[model samples]
Structure formats: structure tokens, C-alpha cells
Target: MAENIVQRLRDEIENGIVTNQFAPGDRLDEMQLAKHFGVSRTPIREALMQLGAIGLIEMRPRRGAVVVEPGPHRIYEMFEVMAELEGMAGSLAARRHTDTDRTGLLAAHARCEHSANADDADTYYYDNELFHHAIYTASHSSFLIEQCTALHRRLRPYRRLQLRVRNRMKTSFSEHGGIVEAILSGEAELARTLLRQHIAVQGDRFSDLVATLSQREAHSG
Candidate 1:
């Protein structure tokens, strides 16, 4: 129950504040969160410590936990490392994937296409995550899979924000289409290149989209 509380609190933070609402250098109010989550301060403290370990939050002496917002350079630096990791996973999966992995990835990509065509952003996001997880599983490296998944979880908020960009779902589906084909055809290099490009986050629109969403949230609040 205690761990569940910690996980749930992390989910709330990931979906709420970390997604861009808190922004860079924004302070996290522990008392407010404790009240909102209907839990004692202990679990909240535990959850914040986990987030800090993951580089998603920082603990301060006087102000408690604060959201660690990545600047443009940090975004680029993180994505640069993530790209290599993803590319390596894709490459390995091409050689190591099972029939089951291919089937699941294909199905997920198909659903992503359907969802995007229907303009269902929510469903698209769900299926998109499923597709990536399939690739990670296909890689057949426990260490790589675990590390890749943790980083993916940390990046979820920003990725979710980026997905809301105009026609972003459609573009993502097209990218996935290429990735699926390359992987199916056992084209390791092709899959590697496409996967890295697919997850690339340094583009101008990514930063702009986060800023736009933050502005909207501020105005609405």
C-alpha cells in the first residue's frame, strides 16, 4: 500500500506537473500535494525522493522538492543519448525479435494509424507507447530494456506535450510505419536510422510546443 501510494503520486506528478505545468525551476508544494493526494507526508516524501533519483525533481534545503526543468541544451543532450540507445535497441531487435514481438509491434502500429486517422489523440498516445514498449521488449537485453524504459518514463511528460502539436500524431504514425517496415524486413541499419530520427526531440517545434502549452496552462490557471 505504501509503495502504491508512492507510485500513484509519481503518476500524478508525471501527468500533471512534469508534463510542463510546473515549468523550469517551479517549486513543488508538498503540503498542497499531501492534502490533494489524501495521504500523509511520508509517501509523498518517498515519491519525491524517487523522482529526484531519476533527475525529474530536485530537493532543496528550504523549499522542498522542485521540478527540474531541462533547458534547450539539456533537452538536446538527453535526446542525443536517448537516440543512440533507441537506435541500438532497434538494431538489436531486428536481429533478435521473435514472431510474437513482430506481431505485437505490427498490431500496435496498425492501431496507431487507425487512431490518428480518426483524430483520436488519446488513443494514439496509448498505442504509440505500446509500440515503443514492443520494440524495447524485442531488443532481448534486460539491462538495455530496463534503462530504456526508465528514461522513456521520465521523458513521458515532455513527449506527451510534444504529441499535442499540430498534426503530430499523424507524423508520428508515418514515422512508425517506416520503423515497422524496416524491422519486419530485418533491415537493422534502416530500423536504427529510422528509430533515432523518429524519436528526435531537438527540433524547433518541440521547444515551441512546450512553451505554447505552458503559456496556455498559465493563462487558464
Candidate 2:
């Protein structure tokens, strides 16, 4: 029961931060949050600690927990590293994936397609995580999978926010189709290239992300 409360608080807090309800640098008061959620302080503290672990918040001495404001440059750098890691994973999966891996990947891809066709960005975002996880598992390198998973979690909110851009879900689903074909056909280089392009934040996509953040900040302000 306590654990459930903590999980709920964590999700609620995370959603609040991602949606800009709790803007960057905003203090997260334990007592106030406990009152707002109608839970004990213990769960609020636990949730803040979890958020801190994932780079969403900072626990500072004397100041308590505050939301972390990720700069555009920092976000771009993170995506650059993420793209390389995912590309490597794609390459390995193209070469090493087993029958079971193939089946899982296809199933995940189909789920993503369904969500995309329905124009449900929220559902597609969840399905997108599974789709990427399927590729990471197919890579068959435990170390690479661990690294990819960690970075993916750290970037979760930003990635989810990106899906709200016009037609992004459909475009992402289309890219997944190409990636699926490349991996299944054992085209390692092609898979690597395609995955890198799909994950990298650049060009118009980068502009779109910055614009969206600006709009959110304007509204929140």
C-alpha cells in the first residue's frame, strides 16, 4: 500500500513536471505535495528521490528539491549520445537477433502502428517505449542494453513531449517501419544509419522542440 502511494505520487509528479505545471527551478515542497496528494510525507520524499535519480529534479542542501532545467545544448548533446548508442544497438540487433527477438519486435511495431493510426500520441508514446526496448533486447548485448535503457529513461519526458508536435506520431511510426525492415533484412549498416537519423534531434525537429518548450514556458509564466 505504501509502495503504491509512492508510485502514484511519482507518476503524478512526473506528469506535472513534463507538462510544465511544475516549471524548471520550481521548489517541490514535501509537506505541500503531501497535502495536495493527500498522502504522507514519506511517499512524497521517495517520489522526489526517484525523480532526482532520473535527472528530473535536484535535491540540494538547505533548499530541498527543485525541478532541473535542462538547457537546449545539454538536451542536444544527450540526444547525440543517445543516437550513437541506439545506432549501435540497431546494428547489433540486425546481425544477432534471434527468432524470438524478431517476433517481439514485430509485435511491438504493430502496437505502435495501431496507436499511430488512431492518432493517439499518449498511447503511441507508451508503445514507442516497448518498440525501442524490443530493439535493445534484440541487440543481445547486456551492457549496451543497460546503457540504452538508462539514457532512454532520462530522456523520456522530452521524447514524450516531442510526440505532441503535429504529425509526429505518424512520422515516427513510418520511421519505425523502415527500421524494422532494415533489421529484419539483416542490413546492419542501413539499420544503424536509419536508427541514428530517427533518434537524432536536429534540423527542423530541433527547432520544433525548442519552439514547443518556449510556448510552454510562456504559458506557465
Candidate 3:
């Protein structure tokens, strides 16, 4: 029962943050949240700690917990590193993937395509995440897989928002095809390059994110 309360509180807080109900820098009052949810402060504290671990909140001495949204610059820096990590994963996958990995990757890709064709961005986002994780596992490096998954969680909200951009799903699916082809053909360099581009935040996609952030900030302000 306590564990369930913690999970429920965590999801509530996460949903509030992602939906802009709790703006960046907004302080989270434990007492108020506990009262609102008819729970004890223990679960609220645990939920906040979990959110902090995922980069969605900051916990400070005396100041309590505050929501945090990574600024554009920070997000770009993260994506820059993500591109390199993804590139390495792609190159390694091309060389190291087993038949089992190929089967999983292809299955994940098909699911992503299905979601995209249905124009279900939410479903596509989740499927897209599975597809990326499949590539990460294909790398056959436990440490690399852990690192990629952590960063992926940290960037989850932004990545989900990016899918809402017009026609972005179709474009992302096409890029997935290129990546799949390169990895399957064992073209390490091509796989690396394609994955890097696929993960990197730039061009119109970057612009779209900036606009979205600006609008959210404006509304929050």
C-alpha cells in the first residue's frame, strides 16, 4: 500500500510537470501535496526524490523541491552527447548484433511504423523509445545500454513533445529505415552517421522545440 501510494504520487507529480501544471522553478510543497492527495508526507518526499533522480526536479536544503525544465542550451548539450552515444551504439550494433537482436530490432521498427501510420504520436513515442532501446541492447555493452537508457529517460518529455511537430513522425520513421538498413548491412560508419543524425537535435526540429518551449514559458510566466 505504501509502495502504491509512492508510485501514484510520483506519477501525479510527473504528469503535473510534463503538462505544465507545475511550471519550472515552482516549489513543491510536501504538506500541500500530501493534503491534496490524502497521503502522508513520506510518500510525497519519496516521489520528489525519484523525480529529482530523473532530472525533473531539484531538491535543495532549506528550499525544498522545485520543478525543473532543462533550458534549451542544456537540452542541446544533452542531445549533442546523446548523438555521440547513439552513434557509438549504432556502430557497435552493426558489428556485434546477434540474430536475436536483429529480430527484436525489426519487430520494434515495425511497431514504430504502425504507430506512425496511425498518426498516434503518443503511441509512436512509446514505440519509438522501445525501438531506440532495441538498438542500445544490440550494442552488447551493459554500461552503454544503461547510460543510453538513463539519458533517454531524462529527455523523455522533450522527445515526446518533438513528436507533436507536424509530419515529424513520418520523417522519423524514414530515418529509422535508413538506420535499420545500415545496421543490417553491417556498414558501421553509415550506421554511426545515420544514428547520429537521427538523434541529434538540430534544423527544423530544433526550431520547433524552441518555439514550443517559448510558448510554454510564456504561458507559465
Candidate 4:
């Protein structure tokens, strides 16, 4: 029951941050949050700590927890690191995946396909996370999986936002198809390259993400 409450509070707080209801630099008061959510301070603090671990918020000296506003350059750098880590994971998966891994990856991919076809960005985003997790698991490296999962969590909101861009979900699905093929075929180098390109924010994608962030900030302001 306590665990469930923490998770619910975490999700609600995360959603608030993602939707800009809790804008960057806004102080998150534990007592106020507890009152608003009708929960105790303990769960609210735990949820904020989780968000801080995922880079969504920061604990200040006297201001309590405040939302983090990562700039575009920092976000891009983080994506670059994520792309490389994911690429390495893909390469390892191509070389080391077992039959169980194959089945899991395919199932995750199928779910993503269904969501994409339904044209539901939110659903697709959730499925997309499963698909990436499948790949990380397939890599068979505990360390790589840990690192990838950590960074992936940190980038969750931005990745979901990227899917909201016009035609991005379809494009992302198509890219996943290629990644699946390469990994299944045991093409290590190809899988690495494909995953890198699929993850890295560049050119038009960078512009689209920045524009979306700007729009959200404007509305929230």
C-alpha cells in the first residue's frame, strides 16, 4: 500500500512536470504537495527523490525540491551519450541474444507496431520503452543494461515529446523495424549504426524538439 502510493505520487508528479504544469525552477514543497495529493510527507519526499534521481528535479539547500530545466545543448549531449550506449547495447545484443531474448524483442516490437498503427502517441511511447528495454535485456550485459536503463529513464519525457511531432511515431516504428532486423540477423555493426541514428537528435529532429519545448514553455509561462 505504501509502495503503491509512492508510485502513484511519482507518476502524478512526473506527469505534472512533463506537461509543464510544474514548470522548471518551480519549488516543490513537500507539505503543500502532501496536502494537494492528500498523502503524507514521506511519500511525497520519496517521489521527489525518485524524480531527482531521474534528472527531473533537484534538491536545493533551502528551497526544497525544484523542477530542473535542462537546456537544449545539455539535452542534446545527453541524447548523444544515450545513443552511443544504446548502440553498444544493440551491437552486443546482435552477438549474444538468446532464443528467449528474440521472442521478447519481437513481442515488444509487435506491441509498438500496434500502438503506432492506432496513432496514439502516449500508447506508442509506453510500448516504445518496452521495446528498448527488450533490446537492453537482450544485450546480456548487466552493466550495460543498468547504464542504459538509467539514462533512458532520465530522457523519458523528451523521448515521449519527440513522438508527438508530426509523423515521428511512424518514423520511429520504421526505424525500430530496421533495428529488429539487424539484431535478429546478428549484424552487430549494422545494428549499432541503426540504433545510433535512431536515437541521436540531429538536424530536423533537434529543431522539432526545441520548437516543441519552446511552445510548451510559452503556454506554461
Give the winner by TM-score: 2
Better of 3 and 4 by TM-score: 4
For model 4, residues 1-221, the per-residue Cα lDDT tens digits are 99889977987888788666898889999999999999899999999999999889999999989999676778788889999999999999999999999999999999999999999988898899999999999999999999999999988767877787788899999999999999999999999999999998432475576777678788877
lDDT of 1 by residue, 80-172 (tens): 677788998999889889999989888888888888999887677778888988999999999999988888776665676577788787888
- Give per-residue lDDT, candidate 2, residue 37: 91
Off by over 4 Å in 4: 1-12, 18-20, 34-43, 201-207, 215-221
- lDDT score for candidate 1 against the true structure: 0.79
lDDT digits (tens) for residues 1-221 of candidate 3? 88878977886787678657898889999999999999889999999988899899998788799988676778778888888999999999999999999999999999999999999987898899999999999999999999999988887767776777778889999999999999988999999999999887433475576778669879888
Clashing pairs in 2: none
lDDT score of model 3? Answer: 0.87
* Residue 145 Cα positional deviation in candidate 3, in Å, after optimal superposition: 1.4
The collision pairs in model 1 are none
Residue pairs with colliding backbones in model 4 are: none
> Which residue runs of candidate 3 sit more than 4 Å off their true CA positions?
1-21, 30-47, 201-207, 215-221
Indicate whether candidate 1 or candidate 2 has the larger TM-score: 2
**Regions of model 2 farther than 4 Å from truth:** 1-12, 18-20, 201-206, 219-221
**Candidate 3: which pairs clash?**
none
For all predicted structures, in order, the TM-scores are: 0.78, 0.87, 0.82, 0.85
Q: What is the C-alpha lDDT of each candidate?
A: 0.79, 0.88, 0.87, 0.89
The window of 10 residues in a row where model 2 has the poorest summed lDDT is 201-210
lDDT of 2 by residue, 1-221 (tens): 88878877887898788666898989999999999998889989999998898899998888899999577678778889999999999999999999999999999999999999999987898899999999999999999999999998887767877887787788999999999999999999999999999988432475577778779778877
